[model samples]
Target chain A: MSVLLSATRISKRFGGVQALSDVEFSIRRGEIYGLIGPNGAGKTTLFNVLTSVYAADDGRFEFDGAPLSGLKPHQVAARGIARTFQNIRLFANLTAIENVMIGRHVRTRAGVFGAMLRTRATRAEEAAIEARAAALLDYVGLAARADDLARQLPYGEQRRLEIARALATEPLLLALDEPAAGMNATETSDLRRLIERIRGDGITVLLIEHDMKLVMGLSDRVLVLDYGRRIAEGPPAQVRTDPKVIEAYLGTGATSATRAHAEPAPAGARPGAVPGAAN
Target chain B: MNRAARPRSPLAALGVILVAAALLVLPFALAQAGTAWVRITNLAILFALLALGLNIVVGFAGLLDLGYIAFYGVGAYVWAMLASPHFNLHLPFWAILPIGALAACVFGVLLGAPTLKLRGDYLAIVTLGFGEIVRIFLNNLSRPVNITNGPQGIARIDPVRIGEFDFSTTSKIAGLTFSGPIKYYYLLLVFLVVVIVLNMRLQDSRIGRAWEAIREDEIAARAMGIDTTSVKLLAFAMGASFGGIAGGMFASMQSFISPESFVLVESVMVLAMVVLGGMGNIWGVVLGAVLLTFVPEILRYTVEPLQKAAFGRTIVEPEVIRMLLFGLALVLMMLFRPSGILPSSARRREREGRQP
Candidate 1:
């Protein structure tokens, strides 16, 4: 598979703390890439750098062969990298469909005067946007509640709405930061299916999830990070069995023998135990 | 189906038509009652225009602009400079109106551009300063080179005229005697209608949607590929344009201009109209502006007479009582409705039907 996004020596610092230190990863086109790490592992920071929410201090990244350096967040979005926030950031007062329509903003080109005049072109464009937004809402199974205010939707539906909104940008690489963070079992599995379906549409997904089973079950490859550095990078099976991955997860004193006794099962299993536990 | 999917009933259509008809005949009705009433109505319409403009910045864009009257001041000064005898210039009302609006729009951009990064109260403070700065300039710019004519103000401003028909002079049209105030009433009404239509169209447009998005969440709006800085600037400029238009009309209608008319209280008063009526609802703002304007006058009629009857001499003045009641009404409305008398459709929906 061709590489869709590549980062080299990406680093960021926040005051006295190093948020990310020379992290590097490449996401292949049409692959489900999982980024799993403990809290403060710089997963969201990496996403922020990629999406140009914050500038990388050390290195650069490329999207579809073009360097993404020095671009603004909106410009990055225009380049087809869309993301969801760790905390859901829906336009709370807007309708679900309106939220999705706003996602279609980069694709549409009607300006102030055109919108004010409601010219034939603007009308046609607006109609297209509405139809597309509705389709995206339908795809996410929230079509029935298209007119409902985004904040009025259920939690799971709000997540789906965020995804629908991200998809409305017509992104090539979709980055989701803790999309399944608050979801229950059924919702997480549903999200797994949704991610797979998104890949089937030929868009690659870069997911940062704490759920081990969801990540291992869905990701074609998984990268592990600890303390702002990559500890392991391989398929789920290989990464799960890696001694260093376990050491990073369960801390320095953990061994392969105690790995089985770990509360959350081994690396690529259910996520009920701490990854960096000392026991 | 969406709740808004309900088809428009004929009754609603007829209600709209009836309201429009009443507004069209309101001046004539007031004329029969007293020309003074017509004059008040004219001022109310002008304030309505100012309120509508302020609503765009505060309501649609969610930018708290406390100094909106500065744009009005800018527009009035532009008109006074071009069309008044103070400068020995006599431009036509048509030419000066747009010039005034453009000047205000430029000022809006100038004020908005530097402060785009600030949000909420910081933005409000900067705008407040901007309004004061403009007023101070108009007040003191007469020194060295006399521009605004200092505190003495500009007078003999030209009234709107079309060829031989001057709006300041009375004319018999359709067997009806159109007085100056009555003529201005119709003129301001037309401007109000145009502004209202433009506002409605903008509220439904993509730009309007973007503004609301920015209002709801600025960071999320940026993620959605909205160039929020430019959009916010546009909101400021557009909102200021309306203020400028109203200021030009005010100059023409009053045939006088002064810095005292564009004080910080004017800005707060326009904001009160927006907040009291409903920030995002167009009709609610019109209602707020009309009520705020007429309420003072209505109090004068009732309070002055009631005071005379109750006491031998006037102890409490009408102005003080009007202000007290106005403050009390605002406080009560905020405590009860919070969203204003007619909240925007989105706010109303969220409040009424929001699921847990």
Candidate 2:
């Protein structure tokens, strides 16, 4: 499979803290790529750098064969990379459908004159955006909640809505930051199905997840990070048992955190006891 | 957006017709009691234009612009310079209004470019400074170039003319005599209606959604591929253009201009109209502007007269009392209806979400 996005020698610093150093990974098109790490593993920093939320101190990126460094977050989006925040940065006041419609903004061509006059083309475009937004909402199983304000959505629905909004951008790569952060087992499984379904529809997903079951069972490949550096990367089966990953997790209290995440979950469902949900 | 989905109520339609009929005839009725009331109504319409313009910035885009009146001043000065005898140039009203709008739009871009990074209180302070700077320039540019004519102001400015029909002249139309104020009233009403329609249309469009997104969460908006800078600049440009058009109309209607007319207080008053009536709701802003305009006029007639009847001499200036009441009304409105008299749908959502 051709690689869709590749980062080389990425580094970032926050004053005295080295957020990321020489971290590198490439995401192949049409695969679920998981990024796993403990707390302060620089997973978020790498996500931010890839989205151009922060300029990498030293790095070069190639996305779909185009250089993707020094671009703004909007530019990153325009280049077909759409992301959801870890803490859910939704347009809280907007309706669910409106939020999705905003995701179609980069693709729309309306301007002030067109909007004010509402020309024929503008009308057609608006109708299409609404239709697509509604369809996306339905795709994420929140069709009934399309009219509700985004903040009014239940926890699982809000996550679904964010995914819907991100999908509306028609991204080549959907970067989800901790999708299962607040989900119960059922919800996490639902999210897993959704992510798989998205991949089936031909969009690659780059998941930065702390939820172990969802990541290990879902990702085609996994990259492990510890102390701002990549310790191992391979298919999920290989990376989970990597000695370096275990040691790094052990350095920061491994048995409780990484054991449950790196190894498989206990067979029975834990209901609301999602390890990452505590975050 | 839901406006098209929901069927219009018959009662609401009837009320709209009644209001339209009243608006059409009220100026003529007021002319019987002398043209002063009509003129006041005309000014109210003018301020409505200003309020609608400022709404684009403060309400739609969620940018706090205290320098909004500077665009109005720019438009007024553009008209005064090109259309008036002060510069010996005579561009027609139609041509001058567009030029004035364009000039204001350019200035809007200029202001937006530098202040793109600022938001909230910082934006307010910078905009406030911009408004003051424009006013000061108008007040002092008489020395070297003599452009604005200093504190004496620009006078004998040409009134609005359309196809040999001067708005300043009284003409017998149908069976009724249309005075200058009544003529200006119709003209200003036409402009206000056009502005209101444009505001409504734009409010439901893609660009409007982008603006709201940026206002809600800039980073998320960016993540959605919206260039926040360009969208914010567009908001400023639109707001300034509307202000410019109103400013041009104001200058022509008054047949005079001065720096004092576009002051910091005027900007604050326009902002109050937006906040009080409903920031993002066009009709609400209009209502706020009309109420604000008429309240002071009503107070002028009652307060001093009542004070004179109560005592021998006028004890306190009515202006002082008017300002005090204005402040009180704003504070009370904010405390009671923070979302505004007719809150926008988004604001209504926020307000309702706060409740059980």
Candidate 3:
């Protein structure tokens, strides 16, 4: 499989502390790749770097065979990569449907005069766009709340709406930063299915998730991180049994002490035995 | 999409239409009141345009502009220099209007470019300084054998003429009839209509949505690939162009141009029109402008005459009482309807749905 996005030795530093250091990662076309790590493990920083919200200090990235260094966040988005923020950053005053419609702004060609006159072409395009927005909302179970302001939605619905908005951009690669965070069991399960459906559509997904269950269950390949470095990478079965992965999560001493307790649970065997199973 | 489809509520449409129709006939209905009433009507229409122009900046773009009248001052001074007798210049009104508008747009961009990076209240202060600087420049630049003619102001401003038709109230067209305050009033009404339509179109356009997005969330707007700097400049230029147009009409109507007319208070009055009517709403701001301009004149006549009739002398000076009442009305409106009279439905609903 061709690499859809490739990052070589990416590193980011803020003041004195390093957020991400020497991180080499690649995402292939049509796979749900998961980034799993503990809190402050630099998953979001990596996403930020990939999306060009923050420039990596020591490395570079390429998307779809084009260099992405020194690009603005919007430029990255324009180049067919879309992302959802870990904390839902939405145009809160805008309607739920309007939020999705904005995602289609890159595709809308109507100028100021055309929009003002509501020209035949503008109207046709707008109708088509609205219909697409409506369909996306339905896909995310927000059809009834299309006209409601985004901030009015329940917490879980807001997350889904963000995903819907990102999808409206018609992205080739969707980077979801902790989409299943703060969701209950039912919501997490629903998100896992949604992630699968997204990947099944032949779009590549780079997900940053704390929910080990969802990550281990849904990802085609999982990359583990410890202190801004990739500690392990493999299919869930090999990853779950990797001693480094255990050390990254449970501490070095705990890994050795719990090696007998941790090794038998094959990564692909599902997250039922793990205490902290992710979505 | 159906042009023939009647509005949803006949009674509501009838009420609105009836009021508009009555207002259309107001000049003739108040014809007996002579030129004073006509002047008041003219002033009201100009203010309405001015307010609508400012609305495009502060209301739609969420950029608090305190120097909006600087554009008006620029327009007036530009037109004065081009068409006034002081320079022995005779640019046709049509040509002068565009020049004036262009000058203001250039100045608007010059101001907007550097300050567009500033956020919120700081932008307002910078704009306020810009307005004052323009005013002081006009006041001081008259000395060395007169370029601006200084505090003397500009006189003999040639009236607006269309083709061979002179539109001056004193000059007859084709020896048949002379234009009057009513003619100027109608001309301004046409300008107001054009402005309202343009504003409505702008508000619904993609650029308009980008502005609204910036107003709501700047970071998100930028993330969506909207160029914030270019968009802000467009808002400033578009808003200033209306100020230029209104300045042209004012000069034609008064047949004179002066910097005093574009004072800071005038800027405040235009802004008051937007806030009092509802910012970001076209019709509401127009109504607010008309009310603010005309109500004071009406009160001046009624309050003094009524007091004199009852007390054999004026009980309260009309000027002071009018200001007091106007101030109180603004205060009450701000307290009661901060969103203005015809708040956008989206905004009203948002306010209503906010958590306590």
For candidate 2, write residues A147-229 as lDDT tens digits. 78899899998999999999999999999999998899899989999999999999999999887778888999999887799
lDDT (tens digit, per residue) of candidate 2 on B48-122: 999998998988899999999999999999999988888899899989999999999998998888999999999
User: Per-residue lDDT tens digits of candidate 3, residues B1-356?
Assistant: 11112244578689979987986777666666777898799899999988888998888888988899989878877877787777788898878888888888898898898898887789988988898888888777887767766666788887777777565654444553333776677678788887888787677666677777778777666666566778889889888988887887787667776678777888888888999999888878988998999889999889988998899898789999999999999999999998899886554364335422
- Which sections of candidate 2 miss by over 4 Å? A252-279, B2-7, B308-315, B346-356
Per-model C-alpha RMSD: 3.1, 3.9, 4.7
Error of 1 at B24 (Å): 1.6
* DockQ sort, best first: 2, 1, 3
- The TM-score, computed over Cα atoms with residue i paired to residue i, of candidate 3 is 0.88
User: Any residue pairs clashing in model 3, and if so which?
Assistant: A211-A278, A211-A279, A212-A278, A213-A278, A214-A278, A214-A279
Please give the lDDT score at residue B336 for candidate 2: 96
Worst 10 residues of 1 chain A by lDDT: A262-271
Model 2 accuracy (lDDT, Cα): 0.88
Clashing pairs for predicted structure model 2, backbone only: none
